[model samples]
Structure formats: C-alpha cells, structure tokens
Target chain A: MKDFEALKSIWHDQVALPKVSHEDVLKNLRKTRNGLASKLLIEMIGMGIAAAVLIYVWIASPFTMWTTHLAMIIFICCCIYYILAMISNYRRINYDKLLDKPECYINHLKKYKHDRYIFNTRKYKVYSIFFTAGFILYFIEISFMTSLWITVMGISFTFLWIALCYFVLMRIYIKREEAKLEEMIQNLERLHKQFEDTDQ
Target chain B: MSKEAQFKEIFQANSKKIYHLCYGYTGDDETANDLMQETFMKVWQNLDKFRNQALISTWIYRIAVNTCLSYLRVEKRQAKDELTDTIIETRGEEISEKNEQVSTLYKCIAQLEENERIIITMVLDELPYAEIAEISGISEGNLRVKIHRIKQKLTELYNRHERF
Candidate 1:
C-alpha cells in the first residue's frame, strides 16, 4: 500500500462541493422542524380518532348490557396504552438522543428495535385478542336487535377485518420496520467492531 | 462578531472538510451532502452550548462523525436506480482520474469501522493528537496506539482494492 500521507494529500486536494448558501440551511432547518411537528401531530390524530370512536360508542349506543360496557372500557384502555407506548418510543428517534456516545447509541437502537418487534409480534396478538373479544361481546347484544342473517354477516366481517389486520397488514408493516432497524443495527455493529478491531 | 455571523464564517472555513468527512464514510455525494448538512444543523442548534473548551474543529468533527454514524441507513439501496441517474446527470460524460482516486479512497474508508473512520479522518485532516483525543474522549497515548493499528488496516484495505 502507498503511504498514508499520500492518501491524506488526495483527501485534502478533493474539494468539489455543491453550493449550499446560508438561506438553504435556514430554510431546511425550518422544514425539518416542521416535519417533526407534523409527525407528532399525525400520531395524535390517530389516537384522537380512536378516542373519538370510544366516546361515540359509549355515549350514543343504546345497548345497556354490562358486557358492552366492559368491552368498551377494555378497548379504550388498550388504545391508551398503545398510544402511550408509541409516544415514549418515538422519543428515542430524536436527532439529539440518537447521536449520543457510540455504544449508548447502539444500545438505544437495539432496545428500541426489540420493543418495536414485540409490539408487532407479541403485543399485536394480545391486542387483537382483546379487541376481537370486545367486538364479540358488543355483537352479542346487537344480535338481539338485528335479523339472524345480518348478525351473522356482521360477526363474519368483524373477524375477517381483524384477521387481515393481524396476518396481512400489520405483518407487512412489522417486517418492513424490523428490516430497517436491523439494517441500521448491522451498520452500527460494524462500526463498533471497527473500534474493537483497532483496540485489539 | 454576532453568533450567526461567527457560525457562517466557521461554516465557510470548515464546510468542505465536514463534507469530505461525510463523503469518506458514505462513498456517495448525495448522502454525504445530507449528512454534512445534518451535522451543521446540529452545530447550529447547539452552538450556544459549545463553551469553546475544545477546539472548534474537533467539536464539529465529532458532531460530523456521530451524525453520519447515527443516520447510516440501507433504504438508499432501494433508490439505486434513481441515484445512478442522478450521478450520471451530474458528472457528465467524463470521469476524471483524480475523481476515481478520491472515490477509491472513500470506498476504502467505508470498509473501516465507524470509529476508525472518524478517527482516521481526523488524523488525515491533521488535527493534533490532543484535540482528537479530547473530542474522542480518549487519552492521547491510547489514541496514538489506536491510530497506528487503524492506519495499518486502512493501508491493507487500500492495497487489497488496488489489486482489483
């Protein structure tokens, strides 16, 4: 190999840079800050819809059965729990936080990745179960009012939607997310290994 | 000078170095630009917090290293087609020999570990051992030892690539 000095000179000599003015920097900073705010707003909107549904059903529905009330409460609590967990995890992706010390960054990424995996694989199952169970209970009371055919169709559709959410929709999302995190972790581990290789 | 004016002057002086540091890690212009800007963005945001206890160059280089490492991602592979198109359109019909050498150097840099890349880049840029050690949060003696091993590996990698 040529001397490291030669390589250093080459690095120093290569100075081609695309023009980036101060205006560009300030504009992009504002854009990035807005982008973050919009992401949080979108997350809140999702939970807002969930909460709105909870209120609409609880207040407007005439079904007075104890099972219906219990099921609604279960669904509400689950939504709240999911939202809280998502918000807390969201903080991990902050630009400042992710750029902590190298080892700490890797550790944070690993824990965040693991928690996301659980939220998809395990937590989703539990979530589906409770939600499905709640719907079944709600449907039972509705079965009293609707015709037999309508009741059967309604129940079938509910279960089918839940099945699609678990087996198809959520699965695709989980796989994509997990793969992205895995790729990042692999890069970080490679970087960390570089240091270890040097030290040893 | 006002803080903003000071920052612009600093950026004018060091933006190229920061860009190359990023370019060395990613081996691509587009990603390097993104990382460089992200690094500077952090500097802008945290400029008030910089107490001047460390050399400004060391401090900014650390930020550049951490930013690039943190944002290293694989999703760009999916955009390979568009990236190729962009590269061709920008570079035009001729590829210079110097450009190839620089590209080869960066590709070699990409082979090293993240910390090694950051450290070696600092060394190549000729930052003093004391300042490099200060920013790296390592002692100068340990840094000297690490730098030796890192240079050896980089030389080996560079030779291995030259053979191909």
Candidate 2:
C-alpha cells in the first residue's frame, strides 16, 4: 500500500484544469446583478401594486357605508404589514455578507429558521384572520350594491379562495419550507459537532 | 489595480485549489464545478469587504468551506459511500489510468466525515496547518490530531478500494 507521504506526492502531481473561466464568472456576475430579484422583493412589489390599486379604487369609487371604508383601511394595512415583514426577514438573512465562521453561521441559520417558523404559522394566521375579516366587512356593503345572487357568488368565491389557501396551499408550503430548513439545520449542526469533537 | 483585475488574478491563482477542495468534498466533477463557481461568485460579490488581516487564500478557503457546507440546500446529500461508484461511473470513459487513481483517491476522501473531508483536502493541497486550522475553526493542536487520524482512515479506505 502507498503510504501517506507517497499519497501526498501523488496529490500534488495531479493537474486540475479550470472548468469555469474568469469570463464566465464575470458574465455570471453581470447577469446576477441585472437579474437579482429575490422572491421577497417580488412579493413586496406585488403587495405594493395591490395596495396602490386598492387606494385608487377607494378614491375613484367612493363607498357609502362606514364598513367599506374600514375594510379598505384593513386591506391597505395588511399589504403594508406584509411588505414590512418581508423586508425585515430579508434583512435578517443578510444575503450580502456571508463571512461568519461555521459555528456562527449555523447559529444564524437556526435563528432565521425559528423566526420563519413563527412567521409562517402564528403571524400568518393573524394576517389571514385580519384579511378575512376585511373581506367580510367589504362584502356587507357589496351586498347592498349588487344583486343578491352576485353578492352570494362573490362571498362564496372569496371564502373558497381563502379556505383553499388556509387548508391546502399554506399547509403544503409550510411543510415543504420547514422540512428544507430542518434538513439544512441538521446538516450544519452535525458539521459543527464534528468540529467540536476534534477539540475533545 | 481595478477590482475586476484584482478579482481575475485571485480567481486564476485560487480557482484550481478551490475546485480540488470542492471535488474532494463532493466527489463529483459537475457538482464541484458548480460549487467552485458559487464560491467565486461570493468572492466577487464581497471582494470590497475583504480585509488584509489574513492571507487572501485563507479567506477564499473559508468562503469555499462555507459554500460547500451550505450546499445541502440545493439537493439532498448523497450518502458518502454511494459517492465512489457514482463518480467512477461518471468519469470512467474519459479517465486515464493515472486519473483513475486520482478518482479513486477522491472517492476515498468522500467517504470521510464532512469536516475531515475539508481538512484532508487542504492538507493534500499543501496548505499550511495554521491556515487550515483557522479556516476550519479549530486549534492547530486539535487539527494536527484530526489530520493524523484522517490520514490513517484514508489510507485504509484507499487500500480497501484498491483490493477490490
């Protein structure tokens, strides 16, 4: 069997050709700069656009009932709240700076995972409740303006959409996200333990 | 020097070693290539923030280490032992007998524990022990002991693979 010193000499003797070029990396840098729209950023922009349209409707088509005005306020608040939360979460991840040691990075990731779990479950539930209540209030005025069948259809669609989100989409999303996060955390923690084990 | 020019020089000097480190970790050329690009992408993004406290090589190694460690996000990690056959099969047609030995060495390295894989690769690359310890976040004393054990284990693995 070849000894460790011989193995080291063999390791040094092997040549490694560059698979990726400098130009390729530069091109990727430019491409990333131009196309760096994160999911959170997209969500923020969408919520901003929705809020703008809501404000336009509030101005152009005035509502008679106080409930409609209150609903508009609630809807706008939800959009703003969601956008802020996303921004906060985005900042917490610190996407630009990744210079921490492995142990520190693992801890940072664990904290982010815990925060996401709370946001996805508890904070999401509160947001959904407020959003649904806003829709119910808006529907009270909607019933008076539209025909009974139209109002019924509108409420049915809205509730059905919300129900689908709460029961199906949200459950699946949370499950997938949590599983990914858990796996990542477990892997990092195991690596961290390996480092620790060497010290002992 | 311009940042781009500096970055090009850094990439030229370090990319080969970084690829080796990544290949040592994953035992797959395609994945190692992707990871090397990812590590350089990060270095490009954060070049301005790099201080003069450490050797540029050490800093880059740290980034590469973190990049490899975080790679579990992209796909499920293949089991360590299963990696050898997959790598051999992927490169079997193109590799010379000498390169086949290199491939076998990588397969053995892949069977190591995650941190052991990183430490041994840096050792194989002939990095200074102090820098390896710093990059790995362990003391030099402990790193030496760890490297000694890893060397023994790797020798065992390589001999076993050769026997087969």
- Provide backbone clash counts, one per model: 1, 0
lDDT of 1 at B19: 77
lDDT of 2 by residue, B75-142 (tens): 66564554433343333455566566776787788889988999999999999999998888888999
Give the Cα lDDT of each candidate: 0.74, 0.83
lDDT of 1 by residue, B1-164 (tens): 78788778878888877876776666666887788888788777777777773467777877777777777466554221122222222353355555665666776787776677778888888888997776665668888999998888888877777788
lDDT (10s digit) by residue, model 1, range A1-200: 57888788777766467356555776798898799879888888898798889979898988778888988888888888878877876665555643355555566666777887888888889889999998988887888888999999999999999999988999899888878887887877786676565445
Model 1 chain B: which ten-residue window has the lowest total lDDT? Answer: B80-89
Candidate 2 lDDT, A78-151, residue by residue in tens: 99998888778656644443567766666767777788899999999999999999999999999988899999
Candidate 2 ranges with C-alpha deviation above 4 Å: A38-45, A92-97, B73-95
DockQ of each: 0.39, 0.53
**Span of 10 residues, lowest total lDDT, candidate 2 chain A:** A89-98
Would you list the clashing residue pairs of candidate 1? A191-B114
Model 1 alpha-carbon miss at residue B15, Å: 2.4
Model 1 is docked with a DockQ of 0.39
